[model samples]
Target: MFRSSRGLYSHIPCPVLPRCRLPHCLFNHGQQHQTKQPRQAVPQRQISNSASTAGSSVYAGKGRVSSSLLIGQSEINEHVSLAFKGSAKRDAPATESTVPSATPTKRARQQVSVPLESKRSADAAANFTAAEDEAKDSAVVYILPVKPHPPALHSQRLQLATALAKALRDNKLSTTPNNAASTKELEIASRTTSATYANTMKQHIISLGKRGKSVEKINAKKTNEIPSERILEYIPQLVHKEWQLEENKYLTALPSQNEIEEARAAVASGYETCDRCTRHFKVGAEGQSECVHHWGKPYRVKGSDKKFSCCGEMEGMTAGCRTSPRHVFRITHYPRLAVMIPFRQATATGNNFPSAVALDCEMGYTTLGSELIRLTILEFPSNNVLYDSLVKPIGEVIDLNTQYSGVTSVEDPGIPTFDATMNTVLAKYIGAQTILIGHGLENDLAVMRLYHKKVIDTSILFPLDNPGLTSRGYKRSLKSLAFSMLQRDIQGTSRSSTVTRSTTEGVISNEGASCASTLPPSVVAPDALKLEGHDSIEDAKAAADLVALRVKFMLALEDQKRAGATTELKIAT
Candidate 1:
């Protein structure tokens, strides 16, 4: 076997350094090298332009390293960068420039060429190692000297750098990479991967958040059901501003002589404004063929472009996708509205009035326009029905709108007229000071043409929780409030007829409609619930209960404040 150059020069002392740290060094140091006086080892980590020129491939500034070697058994001193590189080179075959006069020696012939990439990589590794050691001793880059990693981890770091270099060369680079991109990939990867844990992970920043509990859940947990009567006390305090209505745009104006005559002519001609399409149509000739409308309200796509919920088509992009069985209408003009049931100035607040009342009205399509079909009123806190009736409309019936109104023409003849029922039935229970509570109370008040001060409209009472939903023109619905706060379900396909009374059987006469004196809300079985659309009585009670819940949450907050104050006082005293 041919002797290698490293084996031949194994006994030679390194020329520049007084003590050779390398094991099995390769350079010839016989008579030719012995002529030079030995120099001291570069003062621990002291880097200079000339310090590493003779024995090291790397160069550094006036940098220093006070820390000991981190390379474990394969230790590199102050010149770790150069020491590591020199050691690696000695282990392999030695390469050199050709001496013109000398013949090629056996040792020289044994030399296998090293790739440019390999030489650059070795030099870079040496430089990085030196810089890091210098950074620790001088506090130039890093102030603190980090504890050396376990010796076992060095090989993994090397392996990771190798992998990263391969990936950089193979993929991540552009058509023409940066000038320094060739050998620096390993340095880049090494520097990045050696990072200590971030403060978020190391400093223990995360903690548990408050658990969510709904109003109903909190009440059940606390084991204290707030009294319903407390609703009256907090009603004024809990009422938020910007929700109270002062005037009436929604109320139909009382028709004058001209409006009455014009309305009479319009009725005779059978032409009325189509509430859905906004175009006038002949009621006598009303049919499904000509009418088209979106049954659902308008909404937006991704909160920008407006569209109808029924068809998901952009508004005005096409005609209504849903064809009605028959065209229905509603009257907004007071003169036209008054012709059906003359608009009445609601009796002003007076001494004899329930502190609060929940009012709901149901309507059906009529020849004059939309007319009141049913009205329900429940007193607050107690939730007792102040009034409940199917008020007979004077206009020729067009469509009962029974899908929602829960009224039919079969009993329309026997029901009380608008005049008799409002004057006698509703007048008996309601007075000036009554605070009417209902979701979307404006629509009900407008349809009934009953306006009074001191109102608690739940639609405006509880703003939608999400500002995004509010910006998108969404109103908080009563169903969500009842389910969330009270844990009660109302306005379904079927419900109890007491609160769930049958729509068919509840069509009482004018005399019976006026006799609302705490008549126990008839509680029929769920099977007997005949209400097809929404129940006015159920909705009224829901609105009332929701207000009661607000009072309860207030009571809870008050208790919390009182408890906290007491605890602090005790601690101080």
Candidate 2:
């Protein structure tokens, strides 16, 4: 065994001997040689590189040994003796051989000779060991430093922190004694303030009630139950038979004339000329002048040139007249008579029929009880008057309900009969597909003897708080709804005198001759006269306005939904 500088041992195979085969003797000699001469270790760096070089040199010497074996015994013995001599020299010291020689030729000549097979095995072993050393030296490994992380908090500490935060939040929300006191004071003040306002409004309404005589008349007429026999006496006499026939002919004519043109023709006829002004006041003309004393007031002198005795003057005041003279009628009055004018029946076609129309009807006491006296229809949004007429009931008139109806007399000329309005105006313009909008429309339709299915009633749309209440309380009033939802006032009057006069006449006719002396005096506050009779045009338009507002809000909501849906779709994409 020979120790290398890398602390590794290299073992030599059996040494060659003569044909006598004395292995024990050879072993003893190898031991004696190793004891006599110790080998020095080789350096680790030189050991790996020199290992293969030394093995090749030994293989070269072994190739010559086989040729020597083919020689005679004398030659073989001579070769064995030479080998022994070389072994002696080679075994002298490993240190001397490990030192690199200056001359490569001298190093080759100094190599030890041994058996061919043994040298070959030793050379192969050395080459393998050298390869292993080279592989180990060429390998590489890397190590990286680790970083330390913060330690986790204990469960108890975390719970403590959470509780502390919660306690602090609670402390902040808890009201102080001063704050509590202040909140209570504010609530009390608000209640007191609200109560004051409510009381004020109630007193104001009561005061208005005393001043407006028309309001009392309206209420009385609505509540009073008149006998059917007595109602017939109020009906006007059919004195103008010829005129009625001619009016009917114009109404029943085919290819009906335009309503506006027909109205012009009626004014030109001069049949309904005002007695005082002698100016023709068409039945439906707004703000027309007429004698206020047409019913023969005691204050007016009874003569061909009838004059006002109340003012103690014959000439009439143009601006304000309280006598027999032409006077511009109220807006309410104009629409009332305007509805009486008849137009030839023309069937509503495509665009001729309005998309939506709001309707309202006024009923008067007649032999048939309550009867439809006036009907007003207005187109939605545009608010155009589609059809407006005073419809004479099938039965005789009893009370004109002039307080609310604004109809002064049944004898007013140029007014179309109920049959004519129903056949010519209502039937022609209103169809099954038309959307009829109104407030409390059922009553109006029932009075007119009309059965329209597509109706939007504001009363139904905006129901009262307790809808399950009695019939009278089940629906909200149109005036209340208009004021609340639309922030508008309708069916209100600033001048109570005109309303009182109209109402007094209606009451007098309704009650017969004896009740005139008992009638209430004409007195009303300008601002307080807002809660009175129904105006057809005003009520119809109010209903339409409500529907329009609802539709506008609905469209806005639909647009918002559509916009949100579009945004979501885009986000999804």
Candidate 3:
């Protein structure tokens, strides 16, 4: 975008030539034409012994095309001489010469010498030649002789002054006159008075002479005068000013102001100011605005009266620039964050690996059974916290659940609403082809209000291979699976007996599981006790981790089915 204007500046001061603006010459008339053709071979003749003549001995031979020789006049003559040898006859020479004595270099003429008949006639011819030579010698050199320059006297000087004045008025002078100054001022700037200007005029005359203009000779009286150097200085500035004037006229000849403004508006809508200006543009936004130096050149003013110079720098501004958005405040991870992310559709096609992490969210109700709060996204494979946004419930916490899904009401800290939190966290995931992994992925997908068909539910993958496991697997919570395979335990929620008085008063689980869906008391986790409340991020992570734990061993046993599951672990490690 940073373009150089040196070439443009160089051309700005050039003299305007009318013919230079005309269309360029396209065809080269002097170029020659050429053609190519395939070569053809001429057949050779043969002599037969059976067709012998009466007096000559018979000889026969077959002739073929000779590749060694070129066909030309000499070869044709040789062939003719050989073919008519027997019928050839000699003839006596006639008085008239058959061949000329000398051949002309050009085809138009040849020389034939004839002997002179008598000395008298030759002498008479010689006398006529001598008289012609003498006459040519006596004739004056009638050359288109070059004449010397006329004297630089007053008469010649007056003629020059008149011609110069006429040429200047007609705008026919080679050099442009200064339009910025009056005639008297221009003459002063030229540093020559009428009395002493003849010396300055001489050099101009000499230059004009070289260009084929008629010039008078220099006189002895004018020989010692020196040409003024100030005239030389005035010449360049006048030419420059004249060129600027022409540019001003041309620019003024452009379209209407309304048209120019419309064009400017069109360009402005598509482009923006540089970063410095953008900071001033969006001063109170959530994310920091990123600014970059502008690549624009200095602005220029067109006319002498325009006043603006070509030295003022211009900067461009842009909006919504970020290195990374997610971890904007996470100073430790800031270096790895990518703010202006380009979203890509999840694709299972091509030779790409089929592994992906999954996340789930959980919400719980207040004591009054009125409002629901808390939302979290969990990263599978490692059960890492991707995002956990606490949401203030619409109602107050009354009865606390101490069993099953592990959640309570004390966690809210005046955080945003569930909708706001979800909008922020969910935006990080959910793309065209992302593969979500979980136990009952459909239910989790339903809770998150996100749908992706490329998910792999361990419940389905393992069940298809083990019928017994399938029938008994409903008992397998993510915690049970995690304990059995990965040897990691995740606690569920524990509710007091008073709070659990009526199973009808079902507290809100963000994923919304019914009392019927709860596991038996015998297998319920003792450590599933709620501190202040249950976290959605924790639950989502637990579920995703449970699937990932079982998936590890499941992948090992079935190589082709889940081989890609290990790709994520390798990258994370």
Candidate 4:
């Protein structure tokens, strides 16, 4: 193997033979080679490049040799032989011969035939080399080293040649003065100016390749002319000037105070006197006469002289009487009024159609000092069902029994409370401005702490005639009113069980004893809750509908009374 300077190794030229030297191995043939010189090993260690061992053949000098050597071992078996090619005079036998014993005479005989053959081959090899040298000499030509150019000749050769060529050109009397001037100008231009020298050599080299010399004359004074960028610096100011010009063309004129006042008065009169009939108009009423009217024109008129004159003379104004010729006309303004409205009617916030809304409350009821829990309020006037749930009390108690006017609870432990379900019930049915009609809603509002004024209570409408009956005397329970008006009982199952003291205790015991511990309390007598979910939306609707129904009935009865009581001509019977 051969290694080159680039750290690459040539492939092994041939497969391993027994007597061949390994790249770096200790053993060869039957002996281990020893070197007397102390030298660093090329690879620091000897490695066997091939796996061949005893009996493996090593081809050397036109014959095969066998290896039976071990690394670093002294014992060597001498079976070495010499092989030689045949000469023109005579040929030796080709068969290999092995000496039976190691002896000095036999070794001498084995080596003696090779020296005579080698002397003859040396003479033949010298004759071959002489012929090769003679042929090589015949193919070659000799070259000499180049001579250096003269210093002055090398330095100015280009300039001298250019000037000499120009002078050699033939001149005639017909030559224009412009040509001579141009040549003189080019000579002066060749002298470097500060402007030309300011640019770098590389920049000039690149530019010279792309473009010939510029025709525009360069002056030393204008080396840094950046006119394009200078113009860019003032672009914003120029744009602003253009914008001001355009803005002035479309500027809006502002309305004066007097014009604004006149506009307001016109609007006021428009509402008061109908545009179709110019007279004071009442809602839900018929007009006496139709009149032509103006909605008023918009203008930037000076002074508030919005009135126009009629061509005819004024009735009250005469020559002697001192009155202005212009007659004064009065304009009336209509006031927006509030009236009793049904829950189904939309509020004055001007949402035309009515909508259902939910209500809720937080109140204290259970145990003397228990925390106030949320009370449920549900109303759907369109559906006519009210659901009010009583929450089992659980936060800071701010009031006692009846302190929060309208909460009632069930004795059953498993029933879900108002606090748990009120929000769900309210969001499902009610919205902002729902008119929740209840009796003495002040108490409900106090417990709820809600501040909506859309609510209307029947107790406020029905004040006592005796003057002694305020809330305490005339306040009616929903159940009592329902019973009186509809002649049907509307009972809450939890009401009796939650009533005070002995009555509540007895009622709970009776409910518990019915199952006799054989079943759960609910199995014997299931809770008879009318509105089972304790939802606020259902309760608010029921309450509002109850009031609306009563109002409609009362209005019908009054109308019947007026019809019956009216005096008419009596016919003779």
| Per-prediction CA RMSD (Å) | 23.6, 45.6, 43.7, 50.1
lDDT at 501 for candidate 4?
17
- Model 1 stretches astray by more than 4 angstroms: 1-225, 238-272, 282-289, 294-326, 333-341, 348-351, 410-412, 468-473, 496-531
For residues 223-335, could you state the per-residue lDDT of candidate 2 as single tens digits? 22333222222111201123222321211122224654555565454345443344545433356553454321224345645455334444443322434323222111111
- Provide the global lDDT of candidate 4 against the true structure: 0.31
Q: Relative to the true structure, how large is the alpha-carbon lDDT of every model?
A: 0.52, 0.42, 0.32, 0.31
lDDT of 1: 0.52
Question: TM-scores of all models?
Answer: 0.51, 0.34, 0.26, 0.24
Writing each residue's lDDT as its tens digit, candidate 1 over 286-346 gives 3434678776678766757898866788888877886666677886666666566666665
State the RMSD for candidate 4.
50.1
Flag the better candidate by lDDT, 1 or 2.
Answer: 1
Question: Per-residue lDDT for 370 in model 2?
Answer: 58
In model 2, residue pairs whose N, Cα or C atoms come closer than 3 Å (at least 3 residues apart or on different chains), thus clashing, are 5-42, 211-523, 211-524, 284-338, 339-388, 339-389
lDDT measured at residue 117 in model 1 versus the true structure, 0 to 100: 19
> In terms of lDDT, which candidate is stronger, 2 or 4?
2
What are the per-residue Cα lDDT tens digits for candidate 3 across 131-210?
A: 43222111011100001111233343444544443343233232221110112122321355456556565555455444
How many Å off is the CA of 344 in candidate 4?
A: 23
Higher-TM-score candidate of 1 and 2: 1
Query: Candidate 4: where are CA atoms >4 Å away?
Result: 1-363, 366-426, 471-480, 489-546, 554-573
